[model samples]
Target chain A: MSEIATPVQPQRAQRYGLRNYLQMYAVAARQAVIEQLQYPAANMMFMVHILIEPVIYLVVWSSVANSQGGAIGGYTAAEFAGYYIIWTLVRQFNLAIGPQGFHWRIKEGRLAAELLRPVHPLLPDLGYYLGYKIPQTIYWLPMGILLWLLFKPEINPVAWQIAAFPVVLMLAFFVRFFFMWLLGLVCFWTERVDALFELYFAAELLFSGRLVPLEVMPVWAQNVANFLPFQWTFYFPIEVLLGRLDLPEFWPGVLAQLAWIAGGYTLVRLIWKLAVKRFTAVGS
Target chain B: MLRPLKLFGLFARISILNEVQYRANFFMQVLQSSLSLGTGLIVLNVVYSYTDNLGGWSQAELLAVYGVFVLMSGLIGSLVLPNMWAFMEDVREGRLDFTLTKPEDSQVLISVRVVAIWRLVDVLLGIVVLGVAIGRMGLEASWWLAFAFAATLIMGMILLYCVLLLASILSFWFVRVWELMEMMQSIFQAGRWPVGIYPDWLRLGLTYLIPVAFAVTVPAEALTGRLTPELLAGTFVFTLVALFVTRRLWMFGLRNYSGASA
Candidate 1:
């Protein structure tokens, strides 16, 4: 018998390491930028909508604070400004997989093409979203600065508060991304996600610290909000940056975020499996 | 004009028939509208928990404003918004050629071509809310007040039509104006509150530029007995001028359409 030379095959896990994932992320991010830059005017229009809400709230909350004869929810006028300004950046970071594309794919029978691809249907969409943030971030910086200058919000954070902000924000983005993807997946079971989306949006506005700080929300509502995953998405990060949650509260907050992320990922994986089984490669 | 009117009537019937085939959509619309109206009331509740009045309107008075917002929102959702959305679709898919070839006026045909009849759910809800609000406010519904409210609401419809049509017409010259339409919606959503609460610049913009005040606030004012003769007259005049200008712009858009097709 003759000895045969054999090639050593790398393990599947080793094939895609940190570098490969980083490359994938860069490609996805770049593709997103290219797609969004095609419509500068549309991007500008979106910026107007994005900037409008926080501005409206900034004014609304400021007036509410004034009428209360000092501060409502432990936030003075300047504190409200600080909350919304940082919040503007936080929101800028939180634009996840778009509902529009999800709806369109189902409505137009284009999800079939996405499913046929070797990659997960969500990867390109995530890339597309990251690209979307580039323009949004560019627009946000100037707008945030202007809001900061205009409102002069007294947001003096300690070193760790400033440093830990981005990490918490990234977690918020993933949680939002995964949770919203679950909503998008529900399009598989029904043609009308419009009502569902509206319901989700209403709940989010109430709980996510977008409408008012969660602190000022009625005690019952705050308790309900804390039980849910949404508070981790916006309000938690915003408060963390404000140094509202001290070290003891902060560690638990981080834990809650991790728990939600783990829970969301599991839910998405399970739903995608069951949904793909039910899916007819078209609108349900 | 009579021919176009008849054509519009036919188009509206067709749209209703098409939508009625999907019976589930009606229920979904009701659910969505209720949820939307519920959110508005909840926000109001939250705000009023802290203060009695917002921007000079008491709780009941603000509810009156909300009722007007809902009513106009319903009418727009059922009529103007769907058609404008369809018009953008037409522009994109080159379906405008069919409407242009029709004997009736193109603008009339395009404008009333589709109606989501189920959205009247919001309109009826609006009336109910308004009645409750008005009843709570103890405002007299003089026959004159009724007439004035109707008149201002009609003007509001006209102004809303003008704004939506103008926004849709931009599709003739550009692509993907969905964000613009959405921008309009968010701005209009602010009308759920008294535009009075907004700053001077935003108030001015909502009143004139976006015209949400005309669509919602002014009629609300009529119900609340806050409508001044000057404001009513101005709204009427503004609607008239806007109608003429939008018509002119529509005509110009038609010319552009023809030029594009050529």
Candidate 2:
């Protein structure tokens, strides 16, 4: 009697890992850059549009400050310059492509592939999202330098404040993403999402200090902005950078951000569940 | 000219019929326009929260300016822009060839191909707002001022059409000029505020380079009893130049349309 030798079986390929995710991000960034570079004139036009807003706001606020005896609500012309420059940077960072991609995914039935992935559906989406920002960062550099040169902004900050900037900004990004994604998910219920987008934009302009600084708003409006999560998304980080908020104020803002992030995450989870349920039930 | 006018009338009627079929869109448009108007008013409220006047204009006066802006934008959105902008896309896609082959003046056909019927709501809403603002300002609307407003509004329409046509014509050379259009729009949006508030260079650009000031400022000045004869003359001259350049450019673009060597 001879024992038979058993053949060895091969293992299945491992699912995507951190390196794969990094590669996805890199690919997304490269794709974004290529897409942008393909339309040099268009990119230039967008840059000009972006440059115009800050300039308009800066002049408007500067004029306001000037008329009010060289200051309004503690913002002098130079201080206004600092605030707007920082505002511009914060805005550049907080910009997103909205839920258009999600809509596309649903329309094309590509969302199922994302759902099938072992990682969270948002990870790859976030990668693609962050990838688009790479070109934007490059585009913003020259403008930033030009703004600094023109405005000569007095944005002196403590070292700790500088260190905390990126953290606050990342939290701001998540808050915006979750909130907008939740808005996008509403499309599963209704085919049109444009009205919702406009509503969100209008609210954001007022609450996030996009049009004007929260400090300059009426005290009640400022307090309302404090309660809302939008300030955490834009104004808070810029405020931190501008040294308007001290350590005491900074910690509370961070805490508020954490609360908002938790709340946003919960809302997104609930909305995505209901959206997916509605989507599947409708058989799209 | 009569034939084109009749054709345009038919196109407008058909468009109105098409829009009526989509009753939801009409409601949505009203909602959107109201929201947009509300945003403008809110911004004004915020601005006035801190100060009574912005750039020598009171809140009511600024509202008058906004009314002019909205009214002009509505007209552009309704008539001149719809067809002109679509013509650009048609040219890019070689669809303009169909219009060119028609036994009609191509320019007239292209300029009145489609109408945005719902945009009349914006025009009506804007006029109502303007009437209210004018009443609030307590300004006398004299016959001469009304005439000035009429003339300047005509000049503004011509200037804006020229600009849109020029932008569309540029599509012959550059297929992707929509970004240029968007950039122009953003600049025009800034014109919701008076040009005086902007820096010197921007004011010059708005007044002369882009001529956005003609869209709102002249009519606003008319309503405010501040329209001068020189400004009206300047507007007329600007309109004449814009129309001439636009016509020449349209001819040039048409010649190049079929990849013809000229």
Candidate 3:
């Protein structure tokens, strides 16, 4: 019948305009907000799960700094507290759909349904994760306050730096999101990618200043980090909020983030075309 | 006790047979464990670069702690966690009814149901690291210390098993308990560092609340010459009490479970 044929043809030929894409993102993000908000207790526990990592690092580094007579690698114990407390917030913001989720999507045939949609699947994911930040931040607030009270962290961000925090925070999210998508696209090429994923995460853990400040890392590691995009996600934003980076240092970090975003976006677009061409669904 | 041991051996054999068919997983496990061990060493190296000792632990002694952490993680990963996850999934799907109907202790059956055999690579790797750390430290070797280490390691495994089993038994009341399980695991990562470095409240929590101190730290202490007689005796008592409580809770949870399918 023309009804079925017409539906297939139009879907094949149709392209979404900018306004429609924006609306799609809004809806996807709203759905994520509602879905996540429905599971508050689980999300709170998940937040605690996330928070423990930074707390461990904070405690370790604080002790080390104290043991060294109140300072090491230019960080006092209180500053270390401030850095890792901000780390908790940055962690919430930069959380993205991991490669494991992508592997599951493919294995479970969820990607088959996604392929039928006119818009890129990545767009919806971006919107969803963007929306996820809302619920995530809500969950983070009580924990953040508790950490602040418990640690008595000393952060002194100036007015302009404070104003710029949200912008950099969102940019950091984009950088990590795009890169995570790029990582996830590897699922298209191989099913046995766990080792690769592990390697990638280990590199990120070290290079991203997630484990320790880049300054505190050895010179070799700090040099390696300079050439990587990982630091822009965790280190830059935390420093911006911790009042560590000055204006001279700040603008270049922002530019680097924007540059990485553009690079990641381009890579995803190019590889996605190849990935889609290779994808063949077995069944519904 | 012998029956439970036999059951565990049979289940472990079957699990090994099932897993060995996918031999590539062993390589994957190796890669993952090595990467984590590498990162852990890097963190220790960086920390020690600034100081001679951390919480009175020399670099080699901390490496011993790291070794115990990796080893216990392997044992838990291979023996405890997979079983707990499978048991929780079974509970959720009403498969617990089948488990309950089996002609054996349900707790032992559930506890030993699954073994991720390849994860024992971590156990092997942990022993190697401990050997290197001890070699580096050059401590006086004694049978008493070795006995203490072996005893604490067994008790640590039991304490960890009891805590994890207690958490798993909660699935009868709640549909989703994996998040809580995950939170507990994250809290356990605190053991990668000695609990002595943590603040008072957290140290107390890790020691008594979750028993990660007993699980990883005390065993490491046995090797590092930090285990005192009083603390060792206290840990043993705690382990026994935990095992008793877990048995009672398992019975209670079994009663609470109504088969979703039946």
Q: Assess each model's interface with DockQ, reporting 2 decimals per model.
A: 0.65, 0.53, 0.79
For each candidate in turn, the TM-score is 0.93, 0.90, 0.97
Candidate that scores best on TM-score: 3
Per residue, candidate 3 scores C-alpha lDDT tens digits across B173-204 of: 98779999999999999999999999999999
Q: How well is candidate 1 docked (DockQ)?
A: 0.65
Deviation of model 2 at A170, angstroms:
2.6
Question: How far off is residue A7 in model 1, in Å?
Answer: 36
DockQ top scorer: 3
Task: List candidate 2 segments past 4 Å from native.
Answer: A1-15, A99-121, A149-152, A280-284, B1-4, B259-262
- Local distance difference test, per candidate? 0.83, 0.79, 0.91
Per-residue lDDT of model 1, residues B1-262, tens digit only = 5876787789888888888899988899989999998988888888888888677788899889889989998999888898899889988888788888878777888888888899999999999999999889998769979988999999999898998899999998888889999898878887787787787877899988899988898898888888889988988899999999999999888787753344
TM-score, candidate number 3 = 0.97
For residues A22-76, write the lDDT of model 1, one tens digit per residue: 6766788898778777887787788778777887787777787888886998999
True contacts kept of 1: 0.58
Which digits, one per residue and each the tens of the lDDT, describe model 2 over residues B29-62? 8887888888778877878888878889888999
lDDT of 3 at B254: 79
